[model samples]
Target: MFPRLKVCCISSVEEMRLAVRLGADAVGLVGAMPSGPGVIPDERIADIARAVPPPVMSVLLTSAQSADTIARQADAAGVSAVQIVDRVGPAVYARLRTDLPGRSLWQVVHVTGPEAIAEAERVARHVDAVLLDSGDPTLDTKALGGTGRVHDWRVSRTIRELLDIPVVLAGGLTPGNVADAVRAVGPFGLDVCSGLRTGGALDADKLAAFASAAGVQRLA
Candidate 1:
């Protein structure tokens, strides 16, 4: 199992490349936004997945879709892994697990209330890893993952303790306090959306600063 606490950024190809150039360990390809900051067209995700060079794994984001459909979509898009969020429970995750044909599925759990951690822990075996998101980004919410607000670190920490797989902590993470998150929760990795943006899109300078705070090593 991978033990490094790497940092990942989510956006289009331009932003993804910027994050990579700066110091992001990985980049996420927004799948079906419908609502959220990381929404990109399916074609865009496919293009981005192809554009990113090897070793820097590209991830796909999806909402509460069926496992078979999601797996197929991720495979079709050629992403290394699929990130699933939207208040799915253990049964749904378990059911989705069967849909993963050769693709890896990363379950993104929204830690809004006190029970989210427990729910995520219960569904830990259903996926490769779990991503802690927030409830603020509902389908109606215009800004998906870029609410610019942080959730309770203890929630992520608790979930991490319950699951053996890697945990990717997201939601309102920035260069300013990512280190605090790292120190507090000790997650397997970090995922950022709006924190690395200049305008509405991804920002090169912010990306660099976030990568630094995330502890991503500079490439030679």
Candidate 2:
């Protein structure tokens, strides 16, 4: 089966609609981040989330680590799911299970090296899915996501093979290299942000090309 497509860093409801219309299975609404693009306000995130139609999920990308804080952000945004950009403890995931019932929790594992394999394995059971991205969270400023840099797909593939949960591959995925990524990682889904945008805006042509390249069927 073709991997599901997720368009991230959606700045508005119009962008969200466009992404869904163009065969995106999910849309990512970025919350406040220390460093990265598409850091929209919580109110805007909530507004976009409310406008999202059913079956096409609205995901909130949050840097918040605490369970209560993350739960509050997710609740306020009213998103279908939450993507934790930073590493958090198992307790946070456990608390989120209760605090945000029925909502999907996705954990981001920065594929830095072989250590990423162990990191992803450790959290695979806690989240509904694991997203492998190219980011250095260890940096003083912290690059959580939206770096537009591709990481080692070999390491990502290792994580995918090890995890029972679905794996979503992100980072530097574009119309140009999505097929190669799919071949290498064979992830359950593909998430794109900067790659699908041009001049800080979602490019329709790029989105279309990416969907076609990824073999994603347009939503009727």
Candidate 3:
């Protein structure tokens, strides 16, 4: 099977539906963050989470630091899974694993260098998946995501080879380059946000093109 497609940063119910129609295996709803795009209210996140039908996962992107805080926020948001953007300790993940039993946890690894390989391996032991991205958290404003700059797929490919868990490649992916990314990285999934949008809204043409490029003919 082809790699799964996760449409991230979905701001509205309409966007979620459109993503589903375009063959998204999962839709990401950003809850809150220190700095980034697609930050929505808890109520809206919960609404979108509840509105999503089965088999299509509702992922809540969060920047909460602690396991307790993330657990509380994810529970309130009513999402099927949580994609943690911040760098949290292993203990936090262990706590989350115990606290949020049924819920899935996905960790985002900012591919800065070879160190990212070890980081991905460590995170993979705790989380369901590791998303390799290009965001630099140490920036003045901190670009956790939505930078639209492609990272080193070679590094991501190394991370994919080192881990037993799935690795989803993100950061600056579009229909034009998705095929190349898939071949180069061989990721278990692809998480796209800015690549599928135009003027800050989801574009049907881009979505269709992306799905075709990713070989996602049907969502199910």
Candidate 4:
């Protein structure tokens, strides 16, 4: 029922370029973050949106508290979609669910294992799609995603199977295991962050290499 993801988590324009060049289907723009993994300003997300050429979707990573405001911000920036946190209430989710219909509003849920995943799989129905990430919020940083931790592929695989919607896998994935992941999870798409970057920033070469190997051809 939902599209799979070949998503790339990015925080800067350079990384956006790499995602575009290397053929990423989507980019996760960090909207609001305190000190760690997603340390990007709202303005920067706008900049990244402009930088991403057509066909490459932009998913604004916003907290539940600011999903609405950030959704507006994402629209102004011309982003493709907004990936809201699970805490997003029904009202916000409904508003965002169809805010940009035909586009998308992904939900990022933290599922550590099968039971947690089953619960998430049920709640995951609220949004258009689901993204699997690290459960702990304390370890979040501006430079990485999914705690830069390798979540069990089994979780992604189960969710993908349970949900008719697209399931995007984003925990810890690299070129080395990406292909295997694509096959193992059988998800609509895969997302990458710290695994493909260098020093918390995108490495163009690595980005390209990973993209090519991942089979999600570059857009332009």
Candidate 2 Cα errors over 4 Å, as ranges: 1-3
Clashing pairs in 3: none
Lowest summed lDDT window (length 10), candidate 3:
1-10
Better of 1 and 4 by TM-score: 1
Q: Candidate 1: give the clashing pairs.
A: 36-144, 37-144
Error of 3 at 91 (Å): 1.1
Relative to the unseen true structure, what is the Cα RMSD of model 3? 1.7
Candidate 2, residue 131: how far the Cα is off, in Å: 0.3
lDDT of model 2 at residue 180?
A: 95
List ranges where model 1 is wrong by over 4 Å: 1-11, 89-99, 136-144
- Number of the top-ranking candidate, with TM-score as the measure: 2
Query: Alpha carbon lDDT of residue 199, candidate 3?
Result: 93
Most accurate candidate by lDDT? 2
Question: Residue 158 in model 2: shift from native, Å?
Answer: 0.8
* lDDT score, candidate 2, position 137: 94
Candidate 1: RMSD over Cα atoms?
2.8
Once superposed on the true structure, which residue ranges of model 4 sit more than 4 Å away at CA? Answer: 1-9, 98-103, 137-146
Whole-structure CA lDDT of model 4? 0.69
Q: Rank the candidates by TM-score, best first.
A: 2, 3, 1, 4
Each candidate structure's count of clashing pairs? 2, 0, 0, 17
**TM-scores of all models?**
0.86, 0.98, 0.96, 0.83
With candidate 1 superimposed using the best TM-score fit, by how many Å does residue 60's alpha carbon deviate from the native?
A: 0.8
User: Which stretches in model 3 have alpha-carbon errors above 4 Å?
Assistant: 1-3
Rank by lDDT, descending?
Answer: 2, 3, 1, 4
Q: Give the range of the ten consecutive residues with the poorest summed lDDT in model 4.
A: 137-146
Better of 3 and 4 by TM-score: 3
Across residues 119-208, which tens digit of lDDT does each residue of candidate 2 receive?
A: 999999899999999999999999999999999999999899988999999999999999999999899999999999889999999999
